[model samples]
Target: MKNIFIINGHQKYPFSEGKLNSSLIEKAEKFFNNKGFSVKKTTMEDNYDINEEIEKFKWADVVFFQTPLNWMGVSWSFKKYIDEVFSMGMMGEMSDGDGRSKEAPKKNYGLGGKLNGKYMMSVTANAPKEAFNNPNETFFNGISEDDLLKPMHLNFKWFGFETMPTFMAYDVMKNPEIESDFKRFEEHLTTNFK
Candidate 1:
């Protein structure tokens, strides 16, 4: 946890411009800097080199993803970024071909990751908190936030990164409690990082 890489995966739209995500990133950066940790960041809207991103992952002890949930998943642009960067990283940078060998090919699937860092995801969603973890909820049907974000988690797990508890700002669109969310976010960082 001495070094951190923060990725802002918010995609801009006419209705959402990623201001909240940016603020969260800023807060995390400040928190890490105050704790004497080295911090690096990438905003998906900006042009980036894939090699540099791999290097950042290699250098970091922890990678923090800040994203806005769109239609139950990360934005399309961020998904594209992940597809590109992680694909390139497969060449011995982040992983070394799916962790299986010719001798025991079927035994150790997805065990070939080269990095040993941890990853955490903080996401914003338009859906209300009550909609999740309730078996009576029609859509989610008792699914937790982490369950909904399993794909993203699996991506990191494929590269051998450990999971950190996820954070979410629920009801962000219809009935936002921006100030309370920010406070809770700071508390999250403190509780987890300390």
Candidate 2:
């Protein structure tokens, strides 16, 4: 029974509402629940404790962050959750200023994460897949999902957690192939841990 931590950072307080993020979160919850794994879930709307998240992280063999891409980046709520859930006193001496950290302080991380012996992955949904593809003309960047999420991946790697391949569902909002993406995602979930 591998313990899993799932964070659904769809904020309803500091912002208006996020319907798609809610749906994706529910879908992910059911997916893990159906697998009979022990799962701990947190939604941004629920004023939950960061300690609970830490305890879950300590208990989990794996952690999954599932949510929609709000800006050209991750949701503000997700960033806040990361700040709260992965803050100091939890990372031991492995965190920054302990001398093991090699990251430049200007790059947005400072030895705060240390997910030793655990695995982490992401399920990110983006608005338009085509916009992020190579050779695109509009306001776009040509980076791949793994590249786009390199910061998060490296954060886990620095903390001693093995990071898995990021799973992305692009063109999620306007594409007609969303159901297909969901099916693929379902298959990904089943085969991922194996």
Candidate 3:
């Protein structure tokens, strides 16, 4: 069995109400539960613990960040969690490609991660996919999912852990698409965990 940490990085906001974020998070939670993984969940509005969550991160075999993308970026909760959690370790350490420091945590030891061996992925809800896909919009267009999450991915890489492919729900909250997104989140968990 795998240990999973689900970080609900959504803080209550105007655009965050009654949408894809809420539904998919519930779905993700149920899906993980059925898999028998010991799960720890943290919601943004709750007072957070840096060391405790980091300990959870170390305990996890897979860490899932379920959130809604806002302002063409991640939620403040996600950013705060990252800032608090990743700072405790030698998060950004790197040596020549050929070798790493032996005295400190190394990738081989799993402690090297900034929390390592643990897999991580992000499941995000966004506005209509088209809203973000156009090339004409200077601030929000012509960027693909991986491109948008480059900084985040780089952060994971800097710590020497592999990032799992993300699950994105576009135009979430409109009509039947919300249901489909939840279904996909469940599938994502089952597929990855198995």
- In the order shown, the candidates' Cα RMSDs to the true structure are 0.8, 4.2, 5.0
lDDT of 1 by residue, 60-120 (tens): 9999999999988999989999999999998788999888899997877878899999999
Where is model 2 more than 4 Å wrong at Cα? 12-16, 89-114, 117-127, 133-141
- Cα miss at 26, model 3 (Å)? 1.9
Q: How many steric overlaps are in each model, in order?
A: 1, 2, 0
Query: How does model 2 fare in lDDT?
Result: 0.63
Q: What TM-score fits each model?
A: 0.98, 0.76, 0.76
C-alpha lDDT score of every prediction, in listed order: 0.93, 0.63, 0.66
- List, residue by residue over 1-194, the lDDT tens digit for candidate 2: 36777777555544436665566667767877887877887777677776666677667777777656666456687778776665543456334433233445455344454556555454545455665557563455576666666667765565556676566777655564667777877777777765
The window of 10 residues in a row where model 1 has the poorest summed lDDT is 104-113
Please list all clashing residue pairs in model 1, or write none if there are none. 99-112
Sort by lDDT, top down from the best: 1, 3, 2
